[model samples]
Target: MKNLNPMEVELKLALAPAGPAALTQHPHLASYPARKQSLTNTYFDTPQGDLAKARIALRLRQVDGQVLQTVKTAGQGGGGLSQRQEWEWQVPDHELDLVALADLLPFQGQLSSVLHALAPQLSTDFTRRSWQLTDGLVNPGAIGQRSHIELVLDEGEIISGGYRTPIREAELELKDGDPEALWALALTLSEQVPLRPSDSSKASRGNALSNQHWPLPEAHSPAEWLHRATLALDAYHDSQQASFLSDAQQALATLADHPALDADARVYAQALPGGLDAHGQPSTAYGNAALALAHRLAYQTELR
Candidate 1:
C-alpha cells in the first residue's frame, strides 16, 4: 500500500475517540449487541523496509460477564510469521450488573468520530471495503471458528504467490456464564490441540527475519508470556530438531502457576508428548494464532 494521502491521514485522525465506549455507542455497533464486550485496540505500522506491512495490536476487553481479557497479535507478511499475547481477568458473574454494564457502553458518536478520523488515513476506501467479518460456526460455550479470506491483488489481478500465512482463524471462547467454568473450558481446549508456529519461523513458509520490524514491548503478564513462549515452542518443534524439547517443556512447566493463564496451560504442559511430525506439514497459512494455541494445548498428549 502506498503512503496514505493527506485526506486519508486526516480522516483517521478525526476518527480517534480514545476509548471503547465511543465505539459501543456508535449506531453501527447496535448490530454487534452480542459483542456486548468492549476493547481498545492500538495498531502500529511496520518499518519502511519491512517485508510485510506488519501490524501490532493490543486489545483490552470487558466481556459480558464482567470478565476481562487482553490480547495482542502481530503479523508480518513476507515470513508468514505472527506473534500473540493474551491475558484474562477473573471477574465473578455475581459481581457483574448487566443493566449497569449496558449503561456504561458507548454510543454511536464515538464510532462515527473514530471512523471519521480513520477515513482520511486509509489508502483503501473504508466505505467500499468489508472491514470486519462476524459470520462463523458458533461452538457456544465451547469453541468458535471463524475464517477470513481475502484476495491479494497485483496489477489488477489476484497474486498467485504462496501465502506467507493462511488467513483462517478458529477461536475457542471458553464461556459459561461462570468465571470458573470459563477457565475450565479454556484449559480443556488448550490440551486437545497443538499451537501452530508463526509463518515467518517456518522454513517452508517465510522468514520472520525478513525486512519487516515492529517495536514490541516486553510481555509482562503471565498469559502473555505463556502465549509467546508457546509460539516459540511451536517454532522449535516444527524445526524437527530434537535439541529444544526439554528446554521447551521446562519453560512450559514454569507457567503452571501463572495467574493470568487459565488452568489449561498447566494441563497441556503435563500432558504434552514427544515426537516428530510423522505427517508432512501443511502450508504456512494453514493455522492462525488462536488455532495454534488450541492445537498446542490439545496435542500435548502426544508430547509424553
Candidate 2:
C-alpha cells in the first residue's frame, strides 16, 4: 500500500463476557462521558479474495447517517501491539469507488482491474461507546501521563452468509500523547476489569464468518513464544491476561528457567530500563519451557 497516511496504532484487548460492564464501572472510564454510535460496516474483496491475499481489508461503514470508506493494510506487529496503514474517505452514496481506493493502495500492475473485481464479502454491525481520558489524575509523572487515551467498548456481531460471531472487546487508542500513556491506561483498566490480551480485529472475524472457516493460529516455538512475550511486554508492559504470556513463560522455564532467560528477567525486575515501567515482570517468561514440554502439558490433565 502506498503511503497515504501515517500509521494507525491501536491496542485491542479481548474482554471476558462481563468485560464491557467492568470497563463501564471502572472509576477512570466512569469519570469520563461516553459517546455512543451504531455502526454497520461491510468488507469487500474480489471473487478470488485477492485483497485478502494482499493482506488488505476494505470497509464501508455507515455511522449516524454518514458513509465512510476505510482501507487497512497488513498488521505490522503482534495483536497486542498493532500498527498498520489506514485511509478513510467519505462516501456520498452507495457506490464504493475502487479506482479511487486503488490509488491509495495500488495492487498488481492493473490497479483498476483489481479494484473493479472487489465485491462485498462480509459485514459487521455493532454499537460502540467510548471514553477519552486527558486528566493526569491517574498518573501525574509517568511517561505520556498527560496524553489522551480513547477507550472504546464495542458490543455487536459479525454476520456473513447466515453465520454470526459475537463481538465484545475493548479498544485503547492513543489520541495525542506519549505511547506510554496507552499502556498505563491499559494496566489501570486491566487491574479492575477482566481484560484478555487480544489481537483479533473485527475485519478478520468478519472474513472468517464469510468463508465459513476460522483461521487456526499455529503454536509458537519456545523462541517464538519468547518473542511474542517480548512484543506484548514491549507494547503493553506485561499488563495482564496476555494469552501468549503463559506459553512464553513456560518456554523460558524449560531451559532451567534458562539461566540466561532468568538473568534477563532479573535484569527486567531490578531495573527500570528506559522505555519500560515497573509492570514488566516477565513472569510469563517461564512458560512451558520447551516445545516438547508444552505438547506434553497439553495432553496431561496434571503436570505431575
- Which candidate wins on lDDT? 2
TM-score, every prediction: 0.29, 0.72
RMSD of 2: 10.1
Per-residue lDDT tens digits for candidate 2, residues 21-97, read 87798777656799999998899988887877677888899998988888888765443546788878887876796
Locate the minimum summed-lDDT window of 10 residues in model 1.
6-15
The C-alpha RMSD of each candidate to the native structure, in angstroms, is 17.6, 10.1
Worst 10 residues of 2 by lDDT: 282-291
Please give, for residues 1-304, the per-residue lDDT of candidate 1 as tens digits.
1112211000000011121233234343244333212222111122331212222221222333343322223332111122232323343432322232222212122322222122111011111111232222112244444332211111110111222222121222222222223223222322332323233212111223222221222445443444444444444433433433443444445554555454654453333322113332221222223333344443342354
Error of 2 at 151 (Å): 1.1
lDDT of each: 0.28, 0.59
